[model samples]
Target: MSDRNDNKPQTPWAKNLAIWAMIVLALIVGVSLVSGQNSGSDGTVIAYSDFIEKVDEGAVESVEIQGQELNGNMTNGQAFVTYAPDDPGLVSRLEEKGVTFNAQPAEGRSLMGAILIQMVPLLLLVGIWIFFMRQMQNGAGKGAMGFGKSRAKMLTEKSGRVTFDDVAGIDEAREELQEIVDFLKDPSKFARLGGRIPKGALLVGSPGTGKTLLARAIAGEAEVPFFSISGSDFVEMFVGVGASRVRDMFEQAKKSAPCIIFIDEIDAVGRSRGAGLGGGNDEREQTLNQLLVEMDGFDANEGIIIIAATNRPDVLDPALLRPGRFDRQVVVPRPDIEGREKILEVHMKKVPLAPDVIARTIARGTPGFSGADLANLVNEAALLAARQGKKLVGMAQFEEAKDKVMMGSERKSMVMTEDEKKMTAYHEAGHALVSIYEAASDPIHKATIIPRGRALGMVMRLPERDEYSYHRDKMHANLAVAMGGRVAEEIIFGYDKVSSGASSDIQYATSLARNMVTQWGMSDKVGPVMLTENQQEVFLGQQISQQKNVSESTAQLIDAEVKRIVEGGLARAKEVLTGHEDQLHALAGALLEYETLSGDEIKILLDGGDINRTDGPKPRTIGPATGASAIPKAGTRAGRSDGEPDGAVPEGA
Candidate 1:
């Protein structure tokens, strides 16, 4: 009964009509039963004397007697009923009167009652049949017929609000896609120059880089229809369902020429054809094949543009990326510093921001944030402001939001024993102290013994600036900083007293060391050789890999190299922490006292000063030289500082 007609086969009006008809039929049947009961009780009631007079006068057309009741239709065509006394001569009286009468018992079922009981169940069966029939026609039955129908959701002109201006970051990709918008708006502009619009432009990026948003922006800018669907939509459990859907989608696209078709996460169906264990007969492969054919079959001059977005472009079929198909590939990488600033501004438009909030500062601190991350960061800041009942979101709120996003929500409800708290304080202090001294390490921004996220305590360092590539010293310094806590523990509690709290730290350092030797070829022994082969689908967020063509001895050598690097970093960490033992103790005490410390307070403490920094001796320079002198001893496979093996150590010793 709604004004809008749904594309679904089941119409609401039809369903309502069936329901109303069932109600009306039930009402009519009920009324008929009531009227039948009333009719059986109709006619006039008479006393016993009146009945006798009628019988004697022979005015009754017919008479019936039963125990104490008499009923008859008179000779004048009048109907009457009367109650008789239980007299033995009642039947004889009727005989004497010579009236056409018959005696009957009163124990038979009513005709109307029997008819209603049978008819009610029949009507119920009919109503049930209609209900199921409509259900079948609505979805299940229609599904059998609609397997070939496109599932893409079409957006009218007004449905989309995103335009090119609304999308920030990835400037190069934005510029590359601008022409497609122009082509959609006026195809003749390019045709006059004997040029055809690119058949397709594939947007490739890591997740949350705004690839799908860019596609929607293109549609909005072109002011054309937009059809959005996921790659999985074309696939179904049936073998050929995917191919049929692909064909149907193209057909619909042709009808809406000058429109855009955006298939997000295209890698779901477009993965390499023979990559699966099932071989080429897989439904996904078939769907991908049909998609290739449709892209090839369509004419670019017809003004239809297909834009597919996928994070795993490396796994896509080659045929789908051929020259005549998706010839243009755009990389939508994570936003850089300026790009992140712009993204923040875009998201901040609706937020009531205090004047002190600086996007550039936040952007600088967030080195590898994507556009989506920046938006979430801004929104989180706004939410924090609202939670605090503030009129405007301030810079402090943004800073808090960033911490929450990076580290996680503060776990205020978590309780820790006094000994555990002290141990955590020392562990975080060790990290902060080492980060400040490591030349290649990022600056220590904050340190806290207050539990946050899954961590009991944390030390956070904000990158000074974004670096596109990592240097050898930076990696080495990062490893040493990661091991600093364990080293500090070793110095304080000795080897046997170390806790398992540094498990995550050890894992991170080991991964870095392994990557250096295998993937990065940074190991002196590996000599720029790739000892490990990364799978093509690394962009899928899974780091699956296999060893390259190498002998077992070579693999052992690689493992030894990784172990050597980790030990060297650990030795360096031990040297730094041991040399600055007093400073480490001071920092840990400050953390224990306050439960949290800002980067500025840490810097002051590192300068041999207190938190207040009023009056204290000028501190020694905490530089890379604190542990730079340590080196591997000759003829030793282990990390040796002055001819002594660096044993496995606990954190914050």
Candidate 2:
């Protein structure tokens, strides 16, 4: 199937070859006729005077005159020709010279030869057109013959470059897939115990989590044929084309039993049917229906395993996820600390790195990095090293790579005015100070005035450990942190003088505060009821917007509650900044001087001594809590609030 010519419609090579042969034959015959005419023509044209002079000298041996033309052999055995003059004594003159002259009619081109000469090129052109037309028809693989063919690329064991060793991170997912590989290796072992192998396994994960790599590993480990395709490959604009292709792919898979059929991004075709603004595509629906029937119809022990990957598993059709279809669901979640370390190690093998670079430390700093992200980090670090003419990638390069991956590439070319630069420094300084005083907030990692990504300046925080959930107090602290920049601007320069650098901060702060009241049930007026639908669509993998079910009065109350939470966070931030007015100015001054500051540097200057090695806040507990029990009372230590000793929402850096 990999041979391109195999998919092309068979052309009548014999007939085309015959036509080309005929064209060549005609060309050869035409050339032969032209050659015959040239070879049989009078040897050379001579002047009539020269002809007479030759005759007078008896240099001409024999001559033949035909109408106005003359031909003869000279005494020296050289042949020549000349136009006969209007002399009536020409024949007598020749006879006197014993030239052996005779009257002969000039031969013209043969009727068949003239026809062949004129028509050969035309025939050749027609033959070429026919030949190309046949090739075009075959090359396109269209018309009736191609509609049902599978678009899958078949890979053999030899073609598999990635084995299980090449895949790292998401160990649980790999373990699940290893079962499928084992089944392919020895189907009889399971059969003896009455254990039927799963007909299909579905890999659910965000992009770049190595789902496809795991698929390749399965094929390589099992040493079997692999049929790989994408979900979109099954569908076409034409109705029934997708269904036809589904059937054809399965047919091909049956021939290569004990094989794996991997479909990347299955959600493209497997999306929930009959949903969305406009009606779903008929062709895609038909393709999905055919797929359902095929999976249901196949025997579980057939040694043909189908594996599919998609990030949007929430939006998939329920029928596709049934037990008989994709019996095993492998969740390829983002790697944790240990997993990230392993993934980094795998990627670091190919890169020349300084001995001081520690994968574990890097992994600890990167909380949610997937395998692909780690690989990219390694590559970016290598690129940075090469740019600096360094022989090996160092820790500094890795740090820069991580910053680039998280924030964005540095925009050194971007020109910033003096006013903008000062504002940005003060703005980042505000965030840093707030994060430090707010017990619920994560520790300040680094604050920078240098432009990176879209931000004019940024204040980054790093959690001591991975944080999986956020509580009410932490949510409030985050809201305050987001608004800190604006509050600082308001404090330094009056409200009217504040710049627009806090636009993004205000937006995020408003969202967080609103979610606290509406979704987290932290508002006192709205009670503990869930008011909004935050549920995500299974197939589309997006949050579905649900209308508010509360009454108008209740809606007003919700709005007021949201505003109150935001105001509380804002008030707390303003208080913290106002009390530490001197500290804010000092931090801003340091940022302006350094253009960047590490967490320890900021802490050292704030503490007015060496950096304090203090313990971080306690981890925020998970699960939903009822009522406004944890809501802090007004003026409760500014940012800490009056809740559990460490009731702040924890966040991953």
For candidate 1, give the lDDT of residue 591.
Answer: 77
Give the clash count for model 1: 14
Q: Give the alpha-carbon lDDT of every model.
A: 0.73, 0.73
Candidate 2 residues 1-653, lDDT tens each? 12332443344678778878987887788789888755545577789999899999999998877767777788898888777767899888888877786787756656767787788788878878876776554422344557767878766554537788988877788888888888777888888999988989999988888888888888677767788899988878899999988888888777767667899999999999999768889999999999998888644337778899999999999999999889989998888777878899989999988988999878766777767878898999999999999999998799788777765676666554555556666677777788888999876767766554444456766555556677777888877777687788789878886775665555556676677767777777777777763333444766566454667787778778778877887888899999999999989877767766777889889888643335422222221110000111111101112221211211211
Kindly give the number of clashing pairs for every candidate.
14, 8
Error of 1 at 477 (Å): 2.6
lDDT, model 2: 0.73
TM-score for candidate 1, residues paired by index: 0.70
Work out the TM-score per prediction.
0.70, 0.72
Task: After superposing candidate 2 on the true structure, give the runs of residues whose Cα lies further than 4 Å from its correct spot.
Answer: 1-145, 156-160, 237-240, 271-286, 298-301, 314-319, 355-374, 413-420, 490-496, 533-548, 551-553, 574-582, 607-653
Top lDDT model: 2
Q: How far off is residue 594 in model 1, in Å? A: 1.9
Q: Which stretches of candidate 1 lie over 4 Å from their true place?
A: 1-142, 157-160, 274-279, 282-286, 298-301, 379-391, 395-397, 490-500, 514-582, 608-653
